[model samples]
Target chain A: MSEIFVKDRELVMPGDVLAKSIDILPGNGTYRDGEEIISKVIGLVKLKERFISVIPLSGKYIPKPGDRVIGVIEDVQPTFWNVNINSPYLGLLLLGEAVREYVDVTKTDISKYYDIGEIIYAKVLHVSRSGVVSLSMNDPKAKKLRGGKLVRITPYKVPRVIGREGSMIELIKEKTNCNIIVGQNGVIWIKGMNEGLATRAILLIEKESHITGLTQKVSKLLEEGDKK
Target chain B: MKKGKPERLIIDGKRLDGRDLEEFREMEAKIKVIKSADGSAMFRFGNTIAIAAVYGPRPMFPKHLQNPERAVINLRYNMVPFSTEDRVRPGVSRRSIEISKILKEAIAETVFTEEFPRTVIDIYIEMIQADGTTRCAALNAASLALADAGVPMKDLIAACSAGKVDGHIVLDVNGKEDNYGEVDMPVAMIPRENKVVLLQMDGLLTKEEFEKCLQLAKKGCMQVYKLQKECIKNTYKQIAEGDENV
Candidate 1:
């Protein structure tokens, strides 16, 4: 049997041992050294049946393949568009993968579709070993985001905002009656009725993500909003 | 920058600041002070105040500078013109540059840079006030900021300084003591691992005094580690309670 060293939701710091048994598997924000699983970040320890992981408290987003992200177009080239994905590295959106239709290179204005400063929803196609990001808009769900309240939360807390199998987000959407899109890079878009309430709830989640029983607190907030 | 020496630094086992010879100054640390930065912290050690902000683990600019296997760390240590009694120049100085390099090496000792290949982590430490031992305060604040930013690491770095003054060894030397002290030694370490990352000395010391000073500095750093951890936990504690202000 694997022995857990820390209780669930306990605060852990770097080099803190979370487990001392070989049967215990280490997850993200944790690394195994010898027979010990040690936390690599200042975060909250989460224990599963046979796995242990530490969820970071705060940090910027690092792009990974297949993540859906929202970015702003920074520059436009003939073959590709440079997008700022809220990271140190710039993301590239190739003209060929942006849309289904092909255009004559001699007489096409790509800016009309993705002008500078335009917000776009694109899926990460690849993140190179050198930190170069490649994005694609070919997914049917990906498109230009229209006017909406765009809020940025700590990317590390994205999973918390989403909750188990997206139940938390579903609850927020149902309670506020708003259309919401959460980008893996921490950018969120909210539109429709009760946008303010939805934004408030998201902000709350970002601030209190480390806390246990957060889903209930969010529900209480929404219920109070209903009464008001 | 010179001032007349005080009559005594330690009298009746108390130092100039009313602290015992081995006691530290009043210290306070706060995290998440800057919304714009990925991680930020303000640390105050008595009259010395320093704030550190962390940005990145992001893509490195200047394409050629990217490290394919690990993240590069850039550290900047600066003191405002008004930080001290004299109005120092606003730009980088030789002292600042040297301190910056040493600080970078100290912090790099703990971080697991391999996790983010070809990325860069930028650390900025600004001294808003300076009494003495600003570098130690800055390093402590920067370590907390890195943790606040959630940078993966082996352990948190803690630093403190000790000096010999008036024929006695003192912990956390103030400006007055630093000017006339026989020896000044600043030490940085990974408190959990009990590993030293930074060690610098200026002035003369006997072999026995050096060993004693090292132990004292280590003790001081451990104390700082306790407060730093508490500050980080308090932020989460308030949130865990579902407080609206957090």
Candidate 2:
């Protein structure tokens, strides 16, 4: 017995209230009070005779093309490098794509130029009609990332870190006195005054990443550090 | 170095947040925490929490695709649409696909797939909440899921990120730090082998910064791996000792 309407894209947790007396997709949800139904969870619809499927939202990551990424060199080959892009699929930094300074890439000595031990920052070129990933480091925004530490977070948090209009990051830099760069691929670089300060800032960033009022909390923490 | 709202602190050499270095968000985790699944685990880093499940040694269908000599590993990495602050569009996005592929590779490397020919292994990873370092936590969660399902893996893989910002480098940057930081490097490793299975980085860094970042990344990855290994061993021991699964 509940009474509330959950529109599409609205978040609904288990046991949350949903308005009653309204019809929903069959198999979408049950009407405990006045036809209340869960928006996404599977349940029986009150007035619908034909079965309508309601698929519960299952969390998963599905990679799309053109998404920028911070990839690690897993293995290097003569012409292409195998990169782990934090996705289920691997990316290829083909000889030509890594160093796009040339034309007719197939005729280049890609191996002598970039080999086994280097990590390049790039973006998805295509998932290919065959589902294989092709990456490019030639784009103006794409370049080789060097001399920095990396941490992995679930791809899910990339948004949170970026915050609304990049607010979260703006706050991190202002407080920790660090220069940070966030990649859509879920990699971050925090360059601060010193290792001690840098480490401290990173710790706080990881800690309050999920809190709504984190900027305030971070400011408070930074002030306390200043006092010391 | 970065700007924020007036109330937001932006001190010289101070962080956007007023906190000092060395502070970390509260962390909590549970393994085989649920009795219903073959294997399941829950882990939280700061505010991010992820749950993983493993199912397999099931049948091989379409007989043609079945391998009489090895197990077929099927992995699906998904993030719930509501796992973050803003709503996520329904269905698979590009990020999930990449994660799925990388994750499959990790499992394929470890699983004794050839031994379980004609069998299948399925791993499902879900994010309950997103804070930061979800991938590292997910890797640990994935390992637990496999172990919980009694899937044999060569090693437990642990992952983490390190980065350089402003002239110094640090480990385990959160969402905020991740966004604004200069250099970001993420890595997944087989701690036992001191070997890497996956690595990624972005942003700008000098050669010196890059080396430090790499060192720190390895250090953090190894430590996380240790914890995962212990967690797995403990869970397995509990099962052997006839302890409760939940």
Candidate 3:
């Protein structure tokens, strides 16, 4: 007999058995243990057709392929640059992936292009099973990010901050008159007239991401800031 | 100076603290007690208190120590200077080192280390008050902290102690009971799986008595597990209800 232990959107802790049947497929943050499927992290349960998974509330960022990330240059290697993408693993950006025009490495120093401590917006090209992340700046949207203040929130809350079809962030950008680029890794780059206000709004979103009607609350906050 | 042993730890079907042999100490647990830590928790069992904080699954320091197949656990167990009747030394002691290793092994069994390879998960547990079952309290706190950190785990580990007090096998021995008791044994297990990860005995026990003590300790651990589940659920409940104070 197949049995489901929890309802959709229910909060579950690690080791909590979610279902007992082979008919159901385990998703992210969940695993099959013999006859039962068990939760692997503390998060809200999500059920999709025959699949079930848990969305974690808090944890460090883990790199995945095709994720847009904002990273800081940690080291300037001769051929590749080591970028700290706010994750445990350092992202490697090879000379070929970063630059469109080839300059002889013997004649020109690679550091001149992306020096240490500089920030850049890039896409994850590949991630090895052992957690080695390779980055590429070949996309049209990818470029050096300068003259902006960075704000970090919990990585899991990144989707809430971005909202459905970028609605929440679009509202913040319009009201604060700021240019905001939100990275999938919870790093947000805000630049323009109201950087401070935008930062506060984004942080407020981070703190109350689980709450409903967050968009109304954030807009009210931004409006109040404009008055001040 | 050694204090004289009590004539009897249990009398008239009750122990010194006026509880039955199977009764466990009053327990309290809370999560997210430390803002700076990735995940943190505090646990209390009667007079004994322990707090644990977790950091990482981040890059392991000192390149050579990195494990390519799974994350490594680094645990530290410490008792504060004022935690006991007499002030304990401020640094790591031989006893603390052994306890830390024991606890790390117990907790490592639950965490899914392969999910984040080449990283390290550091757990720091501090004893705020000392009583018998201090290591058990530390284990409980560390387990809660790891779960709170969003570390993928098979199950939470709950620990409790059982001992012979005046020839009676009792669950959850206290400080005075430990001093006068003929035997002391602490047990830690994954309650859901019914798997024992750590067990230590400090004194002699007959085969039947040891079997009885193990059952009593597991029963006590189940009670602790219920408390852990309640506390974790309550924290998230407050968040779901939009209670900002949490």
Candidate 4:
């Protein structure tokens, strides 16, 4: 008989046997040992249709090719900008990819577009084997962020803050009536009226991310705020 | 006048602290104690307290040291000046260097370094209080911090110390017992795997007595393992309960 050793959302320690039987496969945060799959980190066990994976509670951001991220320009070079993507590896943003229009490199200074310590939203272009991260601002959504409160949470909690298919975030925006951008790297940019409420909601989500039925609780909190 | 060692360490099968031969000191552990680090924990074994912080699985600096095939593990074990009565120096000592190397080697056994090639894992252990068996306490704290940092590992490692004090096999020797004990052995292992990653000895013991001490140490480690698992679980449990502050 196919058996699952752990239930959904149950906390598991390293070396814990999460599942058994040859039909079951191990996914992220889990590894296969013989016929049994084991958890390799302290996390919650999530059971999919045919595979079991553990979702880690805390970790540094690991850049993937398709991830959208927020970064601060650390240095401006002739051809590229060295950006701090809040990871150990520095992200490179090429000048040619920064804007859709062409500029004379000799005449126009690159600092006008991206100065040091300025924050911007960009997409990960490529992550090399050597840990070099290439970022691109060529996407229409990518642009400079200004006059907004930026908060960082655990990168793993970004998914929870976003909720299911933008439902939770949409609720926060509607409740607070604010513009909020949640980055894949866990950096959030908030602006407009009631930015504090949006920040507080994001903080609540990050703090209570392990809880089940979190969406309902957040909805209740937002409804209460509507009265006041 | 020189202080003489105590003659009797065990009374009625209980050690000086009223603990049985196989009993461990009161222990407490908590994860995410430090907000700045990638992962951090505070562990206390009796009066001995150690806080460990873990950083990386990130990029390695000093270009030449980066490993293309696996991540590098670096450990630093240091005792604060006020941790002991004598007020030790602030910098690393010869003793600290040796402990750091051993702790690194033991923790490296459990970490899956190949998963993040060219990255580095740095573990820092600071002894806030020193009674006895500080290295063992530090090892326990470091393992918890590593797991808290979400490092891929084979298992969580637990460590304990056992020694022959006044001809009796005792678990978790205190500062006084360590000064008077005839043999001291500290051991660390992966409880689930039943694999020993660290075993070091100072002083002498007969063959039969050594075996007995090792068995007692393993039992002590198992007890510590329970606490370590609970510590990690509690951190997540609080979050699950919708607690705003964990």
Candidate 5:
């Protein structure tokens, strides 16, 4: 007999038993211990059919493959540039992956392509088991982000900021008339007429992420900003 | 000059602080006390206060120290000059170094270090006030801080001390009892797994008395564990309740 100890969306601490059954598999932020599925962090319990996962409320961002991230160039080597993606590990952007055009390293300086301290919107190509993150800028959308204020929130709250089907982000973009780029690593770039208004709305969403009626609340906040 | 031991520490079935044999000192635990730290907590056992701050799981420096298989834990335990009645010299003392190593190992046992391989998690524990069982307070604070930082772990570590005072097996030895007590044993364990990760004894006890002391200490640890869980839950509750100031 399988028994679920906690209800869906319940708050659980480390070592708190979530279920007692072999059939129910553990997911992210949770692990199996003997016949019990236990939480490995302080997070909200999420149950999906046969899998149970916990969404962490706080922590450093862990890079995953296929994630879009905004990173600052820390060092430019001969063939690669080290990008600080707001994670424990630095993202390596190889010269070949950074630009489509082939530039002879002997003839041209690599730093000329992406210099230090410049922020770029890129994609994580791979993450090794040892935590080495490889990044690429091959996509048309990937480019250097310029003259915009950067705002950071907890990485876990990024989803709430984006909202369902980009409703929240689209709302902010419409109200503030700004082009916003949100990175999975919690780095956000806002560029346009009302940068301050857009930044405030994004932060408000981060602060009240877990509360109910967030969409309505965010829309109200954006409307209030438009008046002033 | 050596101070003489007290004539008796237990009288009328009560210890010096007027508590029973298996009673712990009044404890208080709080998390997110330090704004700058990734995770921070303060734990208090009566007058003894310990504040711990966790910085990383960030990239490790000095390349050779980096472990490809798991993250390394670096813990520092320090006592402020005014923590005790007499001014403790600033900087790491031999006693603090030894305690730091043991507490680091104890905390490492619970953390899932393999999740963030090639990184180093730094834990700094400061003894703001000194009473007896300071190491236990430090361990408690460190564990809470790790959880507050959202470090994945098997379980939260809880620590407390038990000792023999005037031939009575008592829980949570205080500064006065530590000076005059016949035995002092500090124990730290994972409450859910019932696994002891850290244990040390400063004095000898009969085999039967040792068993009793261990049991008393385990009981005290469970109580502390309950308080830790409550402390963490309360912080989240305030945020979930839509507090504008949080």
Candidate 6:
């Protein structure tokens, strides 16, 4: 039997390291001092700064207090919209949450607030214990997008598109000169770019969303275009 | 799966629409189709493509998890971020977890735990695309996974959903029907015993509506059970036949 030691001194989950490297595949929490393949994300852990944890992708979405999201309107009533937050709990966008204004009840038209198929930019306001969520877009920061084009990728790919602390997206913006906002719900909004660059950027994000070493991959791919 | 927004109407004795109160969309399933999983299956209920796979009845190491009574069943229910028109995230969401839990419970009900007490059964289900009635498709797919694993069960658990849309109870509501429909009910049943193992409904439903939906969902489950059995026998038969020649 072969055994390895954990040299990074970082504790990780079994699934995560298994996904990245296999020196530990037939093993766990074990690492070799040298010749051990470096791991990307450690699934989920309870370690401090010295160690990392990995969270395997599951199909449930629980709205956090301050996460940026993109969602689609599943239905609309006279004063509210039912949003499929892509979570187990459906999201609700009240009439007042859609804009920054006070309207007389006599002149209010709920349909005018949000259409059934429209996409809305939002932030999670409150998640209730009874399995309901309140969403808000009225804050100055929550812009009601009408001019940007939206594209979607898998939710698991968000970390990739955003890159480590927004580095990946920043690189794309710098290279293509495009203003892009990626939603936690897997929606990407692109503005102020030609169709070619925008398409290229979207494809790049989509292709490398779940993969590690994506930044270099994008750079290499884009560099090929320059040479051609 | 049916389409379009559900609208409440009282036209004739008919359901504002022409569908009988008990009609179901086309349901079909296929198994051992995907090359990726150790064991895989695909189930289509109308436009929905629900896939399931079985992996690792192997040891869940750590030298700490080998139970003597039953194997741990780690279930995952995933809606491909593209399962609908809107792209979804490829990771776990709360709803996915809930679905996975329900699936695990449902399969646990029928599986003989003592048979493989030290092993772990991992059943994974992915909703490839949702037209409507995914719960039922998911049940069918999960059953196929258990079968693919060659795990013995008292019976294959079958599931289906029935709901009231536009004031009419329709069997196996499609995606459009679910969004706009007033009531959505999902049920998992064991046909051999005519027993209901899992039942849930969302939206509004009167007592009578709930009863009607329950009966309809059970009926749908039985029909699905037949298909599930056939799918299993056929898949194994095919595999055995192929191995024989090889």
- Stretches > 4 Å off in candidate 1: A1-3, A223-228, B242-246
Instruction: Name the better of 3 and 6 by DockQ.
Output: 3
**Residues B1-246, model 6: lDDT tens digits:** 454654553246454335566766667778666554545678898788898987745444554776656677888888887778767878988888888888788878876655444556778888888877786788788777665544545566789888887777778777766777688888998775577888888898888878888888888887887777676545534543333221
> How many residue pairs clash in all the candidates, one count each?
0, 92, 0, 0, 0, 29
**In candidate 3, how many clashes are counted?**
0
Interface RMSD per candidate: 1.8, 15.1, 1.3, 1.6, 1.2, 16.5
Model 2 achieves a DockQ score of: 0.01
TM-scores across all candidates? 0.93, 0.47, 0.96, 0.94, 0.96, 0.48
TM-score chain B for all models.
Answer: 0.96, 0.84, 0.96, 0.96, 0.96, 0.87
CA deviation > 4 Å runs, candidate 5: A223-228, B1-7, B244-246
**Which model, 2 or 5, shows the larger DockQ?**
5
Candidate 3 regions exceeding 4 Å error are B1-7, B241-245
Task: Find the 10 residues in a row with the least total lDDT in model 5 chain A.
Answer: A203-212
| Model 2 per-residue lDDT tens digits across residues A1-228 | 323354433333222344554443324322232354332221111232333232222211224677878777778676678886655456787877776465454565555555555556787888743235788887887876666566554344566567689876676667667666666565565555633454454455543343346666666766677677
lDDT of 2 by residue, B1-246 (tens): 234424422245455454333333455556666555656777666767889887665555666887766778887777788887677776688988887888788767655575455656777888888766777667768776665454545556667777765555767666667666666677778765577887777788888878887778888776665556556445434543435342
Question: Candidate 5, residues B1-246: lDDT per residue as tens digits?
Answer: 245676788999998778998887899999989988889999999999999999987999988999999999999999999998779999988999999999999998999999999999999999999999999999999999998888999999999999988888889999889988888899999999999999999888989989998999999999999999999888778877776544
Error of 5 at B116 (Å): 1.1
Best by DockQ: 5
Clashes of 4: 0
- Over the stretch B1-246, how does candidate 1's per-residue lDDT look in tens digits? 446888877788788778888889889999888888988999998989999999988878787998888999999999999998889799999999999999999998889888788889999999999988999999999998998888988877889999998889889988778887677788999987789999999998999999999999999999998888888878778767766564
Please state the error at residue B126 of candidate 3 in Å: 1.0
RMSD of 5: 2.0
True contacts kept of each: 0.84, 0.00, 0.84, 0.76, 0.79, 0.00
The predicted structure with the larger DockQ, 2 or 4, is: 4
> What value does the lDDT take at residue B65 in candidate 6?
74
Better of 4 and 6 by TM-score: 4
